[model samples]
Every structure is written in structure tokens, then in C-alpha cells.
Target: MVRANRRLLRARYGRYEGGPDPLAAPVDLTEALDAIGEDVMAGSSPERAMREFLRRGGSDRAGLDDLARRVAERRRDLTRKHNLDGTLQQVKELLEKAVLAERKQLARDTEMDDGDRMLAEMQLDALPASPAAAVSELGAYDWKSSEARADFEKIKDLLGREMLDQRFAGMKDALENATDEDRAAITEMMTDLNALLDAHTRGEDTPEQFDEFMRKHGDYFPDNPTTIDELLDSLARRAAAAQRMRNSMSQEQRDELDALAQQAFGSPELMQSLSQLDGTLRALRPGENWGGSEQMDGEQGLGLGDGTGVFQDIAELDALSDQLSQSYEGSRMDDLDLDALSRQLGDEAAVDARTLQQLEKALRDSGTLKRGSDGQLKLTPKAMRQLGKALLRDVASRMSGRQGNRDLRQAGAAGERSGATREWAFGDTEAWDVTRTITNALTRTAGEGGDTTAGIRIEIGDVEVQETEARTQACVALLVDTSFSMAMDGRWVPMKRTALALHSLITSRFRGDDLQLIAFGRHAEVMDIEQLTGLDAQYDKGTNLHHALLLANRHFRKHPNAQPVLLVVTDGEPTSHLEASGDVFFSYPPHPVTVAVAVRELDNSMRLGAQTTFFRLGEDPGLARFIDSMAKRVGGTVVAPELDDLGAAVVSSYLSSRRSGGSGGAGEDFDGMFGRGWGRWG
Candidate 1:
């Protein structure tokens, strides 16, 4: 993959000029909105819902759930790798068996002097009970078993490398294989690296100085950083990890490792150069973690003598790097290893982090949601439209469960064509009825075909408007209950969806008609589709059906020449009434004044020839009884609907009403809607 990317870059730039990691792609609107809807329906506030939306790691690669599993796996891996209890037992058994074998071998060496044999026995007897102590003492002793000696030698090598390698990668390899010449070369690299850091710190370093340093010692760092700052950043992280490792180890372990680190390259000067480099890096990158603690699950047998320091360092670096670049914003995010992230954090979590970062980037790039002047993320107009369209599509899908092509001619302006061609009219909003209009134009043009009719064309007389069956335009008011109780019952999103669906249908399909939305709770207010969808459900002191009905009446009055259609969606009865002065009077146990006020408003609507339908939700007896009684008084339709089917029910009814030419009026069996609900709601 690296080779391919390199080739691609070379082709693009004429050289291998690498760049940063690409930001994540945008999440699908359907998925994002569905998650948002779920959170909102679960009673989260809009702000909380947005937070939840962002929290899910917007990518398909992983999520919070995946990350949690990875964290567990990491913990288990640490425990398994550093199992000090089991390792200590193994070391003790090996030590005892080796000592016994050595004593037996001494007895078989018959040519040995008696004094030498006694001395050998004394050395074997001197072996301590503690494995750590015995191993420490065995440095000068001759071992009977080469295997045991080899094992002990491996322990020393492991301990030595663990101490040095925490501060620097490949230190173990260098220590095991580096010759005197190589050690000298490492010392030179360290000295130059520190010099560069110091020069850079003093603001005396130039690109030339960086180039010179890299030219001389670039082989030390395989990442091949292009800039001085990049190299420093790389060094700083490792240096910090080493310091943290020192901090996490026991004092005794620290002391032992301090001695062991010196033996790494077999040169004191190499260690000293490294020591100076560490100081310079630390001073330059003070922001790195220098004081942090981690719980050692056991005596982690990282190195032979005191590998605890190395294990602790590894753990700390894992934690630090996990936070710094795990699909999050970073100065050099491309340096991250995503596969390693999945191994450490779990694939699910990795995917989540990746996707979340992508979502943020997508949001920023798309400009759909933005930080406003107040520094708060606010949805842009484009975002709102997209969200509304997404919601409309969902509602449309639900309504399409059973369908045929809808004849929208009833929704068009009413007229009967005399089967003639004419110029376009000012009020023709419907699509051109192509058959008759085109046929008429062609018939006229064919006879006029020559005489400035060089083309088979008629002039303005060629255009015509298609006529429709006569039907009056309807003035529709959709009143939605936006009370706290609606949210509590998980009916708020459905209500909003229904309103958006019906709004879209009317505005898009029946543009000649007047459509208004009124939201009623403790008070009532007029809201457009956008405002209504964003409206938060709060303050349940009242369900102001009176104010809502009054608004509907006002709409009817504005369109007195048209049919008046009213649709009310509610989960509760009116618990508040309007005062004569217009302040709301709220109560709980069915206030007579509130009910009267509400009923009187409905009567006014009825007087205006408004046809009403009450879509009731929930099973509260008081609500059911009151809505039933109210529907009866106003002679409106009553339909108690499942929340999921509310949009389909309402939309179908509106279409049916238009088709029936306002047939289900006062005293009509509105319950006979599509021959299904007249009995159910009645």
C-alpha cells in the first residue's frame, strides 16, 4: 500500500511528496437522521441528541462499542505479557534444578582437586532462595547446564534492552548487534540530534542546519521526517515515554535499570550522549506527559532484573498515543496506525473514532452545520432543508406501503376546457396536460405550415391550458400538540413527521391551497415547517386547544372563499383556557372554563364551515373521552391512530377529502374514512 501510494504521489508531484491523512467521508443523511430521531424519541433534548449523533463515531469502520471491546483486549494482553507471578515461579524452578544439576556434575568430575570440588559445592550451596537475588549473584559462577546459563544470559539481555529501548526504538537490536564502530556512530548521531534541538531552541537553526544534520544522521530515524519540527516531535514523544517509564517503576527497579541502560551499547559515552539528548527533548517538549501513574496489575516481568520500567513505559505510551491520534485531530494524524488501533482499542471503537472524525470533517466541509456568531453549532439553511427532505422522504415511504399513481387533478385548479388553444394564463400552476394542448397546437400549425410558417409552427395561439374537474381550493390548518407529555409518551417525533409530510404534500402537490401550522401547548403560536420541526416540547401546564382552534378559524377567515379543512393531532385534552384578557388559565382535573373555552373555539371553527378531524394518540381515558366528546360537538371526524401510521392516515384522509369534494361534513360519517375508521373512532 505504501509503495502504491508512493508511486501515485510521484506521478502527481513528479517526486514522492507525501501529505497528511485524508479526513473521513460524510455520513449518509438517512443514517445520521435516523440516529438523531432515535435519540430525540428517547427523550434527549435536541442539543443532547446532536451530541449523541456526534458521539457514535460517524464512520462505518468502528464505534464506541468497538472501542470498549478493544480496551478490554488491551488490558488482557498486558496481563498476559507481563505475568510476573507465573514468570517468578518458573525462574525459581529453573534455578533449583540447575543448582542440583551443577552439584551432580561436580561429583562426576573425578579429576578435580578436593579443594576445587569443595569450593564448587560451596558456590552451589551459596545460591540464595530468592530467584532475583540468586540471578544477581550468578554473574561469576560457572553453570553445569549451558541451557540454564543461556536462559539466565537471555534474562540479562532482556533486562538491559528493556531499560534502553523504552527511550528509543531499535535500541535492543543495536545493543545486541552493534560493534564498537556502530556504538561510536550512535553516539555521534545523538550528539548531532541534541545540537540541532539546542540550535532550534535558540532560534539559530535554519533549514540548512536541519539538512546538514539529517544528511549526517538521518538513518537513525526511519520515518524520514521532512522538517526539523517533525523530527523533534517524534523524539519528544519517545523521550517523554522513557521519563514516564522511569516514574512508574519501583525505586529499586529504577536503580537497577539505571545501571543496565549504561551497558546497552557497551560505551559510557553513548549513554551520556543519549542522556543529554533526553534532557534537550524534554525541555523542548514540556507538554508531553511527565507526571502520570498507571496501576501495574502484577509484577510485570518485562525485563529480567527490572523490565517493570519498560512495561510501564509501554503502557503509558500506549495510553498517550491512543488519545493523541486515534482517529482524532492531530498535527500529523497520518502517522497513526489504524490497524494497531483496532488491535489495541478494538475494531468497533476504531471504526467509531474514525467515522466520528470523518463526520466532523464532513460537517465542516459541507457547511451544513456551523458554529454561529455565538460559537454554538447551528444548522445552516441547507442543512435544515436536507433534514426536512430526509424526513419527508421517510414519511412518503411509510405512506407508500400500498399505492397507485395518485390523480392530482382534484388538487389542481377547477375548470372545464372548451378543447381550445390559447396563450398561457397567469394562474396555471399545474403541469401542462400535454395530450390535448399539443394536439390542438399541431392541428392548427399543420394548416398554417408555409407563409411565415416556414416551420410547422403556430404563434402564441399554439399554447393552451388543460382544464380540470371543478373543485374549490381548501384552506388547511394542521394543529400539532407540542406539550411535554407528548415527548414523555414518545409521540413528539411522529407528530412532527406527520406535519412535515402533510406540509410537503400540500405545498408540493396542492400549491393552489392555503396550508398553515399552529403549535399549541401552554399557549399557541404560528410556525412554519422548519420552526415547527425544531420546536422543543416543554412546559406542560396546558394543552391550549382553544388558542389552536382560534388560529385555525383565523386561517379559515383569511380564505373564506375556499373550503376550510382542519386537522388536530393531540395526546391530551385541553387543560387550559384563555382568559378574557388573553392570559392562559391552566388546570389539571378538566377545568370547566378551559373545556368550555376549547369547545367554543371549535364551535367558531364549525360556524366558519371548517371541516375538522381529531387524530387522537395514547390511551388516557380522560383524553379519549374528551377528544371523542369534542369531535361529536363540532361534528368532526375522530380517528385514534397508531403513532407509526399517523402520517399515512392523515395524508390519505386529506387526499380522500379532496377527492370526495368535502363530502364528510357535519353529521357525515367521517368515521367511514376509506371504509375503515368511521366505526373505530366513533
Candidate 2:
């Protein structure tokens, strides 16, 4: 291990020392899921949250706006590569001037006749009208300038083998620095490929056929597709890309391609073969996206007179564009083209894309969130517990607070243990002290060794159980106001945080605890553990605390032995109440009727012996007085906590309630939660 470490240290990084980072790790599912949850809680839809995750990646601050700028930079680079206006114009000028020069010389010839001059002028006039026609017409004409001939040769070369290479991969390599044998090799490969496709389309091909073809022509297909379907998919995409390239061109460009086909390799049959191959591919994978226009924006035009690489580049961009837009539910994010992304952006961006794919895969496979029967993603129970625990852990970490550190003891239980042993009782709830029970058996069987030497044995008389402290199971109703105001005022996420943190604490620490999430908005409704986590804020204006209280009573009655712990998180005063007719009555300035109905519900909660805690979010004086009066009337605690520390405050209050049974000096306990004075907020 030490030698391996030394070797690793000695390895040189080369040019990568200060270049783009290569140490890209996969995105952790927990972090991505938490970010998704946070964005959802902040009022973003699940789809929007997933897009945000893809764009911003693991960066905490980078948003969609930043991503837009980066994508624009990539578009600028692409524009530089694809801007081929200048070269096409040059091709037009070279052909036009060469033909005109030929006509001028023919007109100046001493032996020229009238009929011949008329014919020369007519052809010269037709030159600019059809550039491709003029170029083919002047193929046999001698050029006055050698530069024009050289330019035409370059254009012909680019149009010939390069275009063929677009349809058939690896044509450039085969045609490079070779003789007749190489050209014959490509011709043979094309014929076989076309034959294979035809056989497959007619339902006459076997897997062995594809395998044999790949074994012979594997270099042309670097994708190394394992199945016939995979090969077809690849071939179809390339063929579609080639077709779309033609579709994107202007009329003059199409004319040029047509004329190039006439002159390519001194063989018109090559174009016919490619056309046949394209038709076969289309029949196989007809669903491929073959339409779309991407604008390459730049101030100046580009010089792309080399080969058909620009066309290939645009085709690749189109393929990547389709891959990045994953729309279906639980789509495999691994299908994203990392190499294309790397080419468009930097290597660093490819790393980020890989990480995002990892995160998406992890989320799909984790089974924490599953698609419901209605095809909507809903969190499972396991997801709720996982997310809740994370939130609770964050709250606990923040509890160290301004004091730098503090010892946190497990809160006191309901009943104390006698710390004595007893013979097995028929109906005891106490935990058995395994060590003490074993020792009792050993003492009883001190001299009773048999075939199994020194094996201690005891009958029912010697079995003893130890007593530990009895725990209290509380029925908790976390009342989160899911009204528009909570969302507007940036209090929505904090409210969710408080709920998750408290739910996790109760479920994990107090095993028998019964926690129900009551989301109150226009009307109150009881949500299960998972529903509360993914619940979006409603656009309703009312805060119907009355309905929430009614449901709390039902839960308490159901769990008769459990203590009722009511925790209300809201940003506004009661704006609505439940009417006797089962309707929700909304009011602005707190109607006397609404206030009366709310107070009546509070009275009912007090009668049921609920240990209430009102967490006021906003600092409106009217709202503060309302919560204060309600807390005083119920003999409960009122905490007006800052949004960030709300979770910590609620958790501290619950722990204190467990220790003191919701009585004694609770104010000091909440103050110590943040290691600061909470008397001011109150």
C-alpha cells in the first residue's frame, strides 16, 4: 500500500496541472434529491426542479440565467464553425469569373465567327443564373487563371469523398494516401452494407449475418453495437443527420450537391447506392427526429471551404440536442451524449453532465420516489423517512449555536424505571436486561454441567426481566399553512423544513409516536408523511386553522393513549374559518364571526389537553398579538422564530415537552435552542 501510494505521488499530471479539472465524481443522490426537494418547496414544479438540477448541477448559487449565458457561448463557437456563407460566395465568384473570362477571350479571338460568339455570350449570361450548371458546363473549358482551377479542384474534392464520408463513416481514412485497391474496398463495403439492410428490411436476415458484417467492417462502425437493433439505430441516426443536413441547405446549396453527385468519383452509381442505403435506414427507424433548425449567431461569416465537416458538426449538434431534452418519466439519463457535450462545451462540462446523469439514474433506481397509478411521481414511505432524517440532522447540527458547543441529553421519558429484576411476568412492557438474565441462569446452574460442559441452563423460574424507563407516545399534528402568502413571502421552504425535522425526530426518537401532517390553506386536509414532503403551496388565500384543529381532535381520539402535541407553523393570522354548513368563509380584517369560530376550535383543543406551540413566521403586530393571545388562552408556548432557525426552535420545543411533559419553564429551553434570547421574538 505504501509503495502504491509512492507510485501515485510520482505520477505526473502533464498539461493537466492547471487545465480543466478531470477529477469529476458522480453526483450524490442524497444531495440531488435534497436540492430537488428544496426547489419544489420554493414553488418550482417537479419538472422545473429537474431541469434546474440539470442546468445548475451541484452548484448552490448558479441558476438558469447562468446556464443561458454558458450555452450562448457554446452557440457562438458553433456559429463560427458553421458560418459557411463566405466560402459559398467565393465558389460562386470563381465559377462566374472563369466562365466570363472564357467568353471574353472567345469574343476577342481573331478567327471567331458571329454564330460562335453568339453562342459564347448566351452561355456566359447563363453562368450566374445557375452556378452549379455553369461549373459542370465549364469542366472541359481551359481556365485563364490557374488559381480558379485550383479553387474548383478544392471544391470538387470537398464535395466528392467528403460528402460520401458523411453517409459512410471512415471513408476519409480509406481514401487517404491510397491506390485503386482502397477505393474498391470502400465500394465492396457499401455494397455489402446495402445488401444487409435490404435483407433485414425484408425479414430475411439473421443475427449471424450482422455479426459477420461487423467482424468485416467494424472499423467503419466505432460504436461497436452489440445487436442488430443497435446497429440500425446508429445507422438511422447518421442517415437522418445526413438527410437533415440537406434539408437545412438553401436552393443553391442543393443544386451544388446535385452537381457534385454528377462529378463524384467518376461514378454516378455511388450516389445511387447511398440513396438506396438512406431509404433502407429510414424504413427501419422512421421515428428519428429529422427536422429542426438551429441558428448559429455570430457577427462575421466563417471559412468552411475544407470538407463537409461543418455539415457533420451541425448533424452532431442536432443529435445532442435531442438527447439532452429527456421528457419522459424515468427516462434513462445515461443516454445523454457525453462526447458531444464535451465537444460543445469543455471537458469540465461533460463531467458535470455525467454527474447529473448519475444523479438522475440514482433517483430512478433508489425506489424512494415511485410513479403512482396516475403516472405522477410520489414519494414512498422510505423516501419520507430518508429526507426527514436528513432535515432533522441539519436541525440538530445547528443547535450547537452561539455557545460553540452544548451537551444534548435525550429528553426525559414519561415513566421512570425501578432498576430491579423480576421473574418473567405474564404482561410486562419493560426491556429485558440480557446480561443480568444470563448471569442469573449461570448462578442457578453453577454445578449442573452435563454433556455440554459448563453450559448454563435455566427453566421458567430463573428467567428474569429488567425494567427501563417507560416512553411517552405523543400524537403530533404539524399544521403547515400552505397558503399563497407562505409561498410569496419565502416562508414555504422553512415551513417544510420545520415539519420534516420534527417528524423525523418524533418517529426516530419516540418509536411509538403518531405524527400526522395537516396542511391548512383555503381548507384544511390531513396528508400522509409522503404527501406533506412533495405538497405544493396552494393559491388559496385563507388560513383555516379551525379545520386543522378539528382534524387534530380526530387523531387524538383515535390514539387515545397518546398525548396530543399540536405544532402550528403559519405566516399570517386566521383569515378564514369553517362554517357550520361545511363551507370555508374567508375574511380580510379578521371577521368577528371568523375569530369566534377559530377561538371555539382552540377551546376544544385545550379541553382535549393538547400541548400547543404556535410558530409565528411574520412580524406583523396584529398576527403576533393573535398568536400570543391564543398561546395564553391554551397555556401553550408562542415562539416567533427567524425563518432559518424555525426548524431548530420547533425541535427544541418538542424535546423539552418530552422531558417536562409540556410544562415547567419552556421559554428558557427554546431560548437555549439558538443560544440567544427569544424573549424579543415573543
Error of 1 at 74 (Å): 2.6
Clashes of 2: 0
lDDT of 2 by residue, 365-443 (tens): 7875577888766556776677787787788676654443332323232356657666554334445667777777776
lDDT of 1 by residue, 171-199 (tens): 66666744557656766777778788889
- lDDT of the structure predicted as candidate 2: 0.69
**Candidate 2 off by > 4 Å:** 1-27, 39-55, 60-76, 83-163, 169-307, 328-330, 338-351, 404-490, 512-527, 534-536, 539-566, 571-612, 668-680
What TM-score number comes out for model 2? 0.66
RMSD of each: 8.5, 11.2
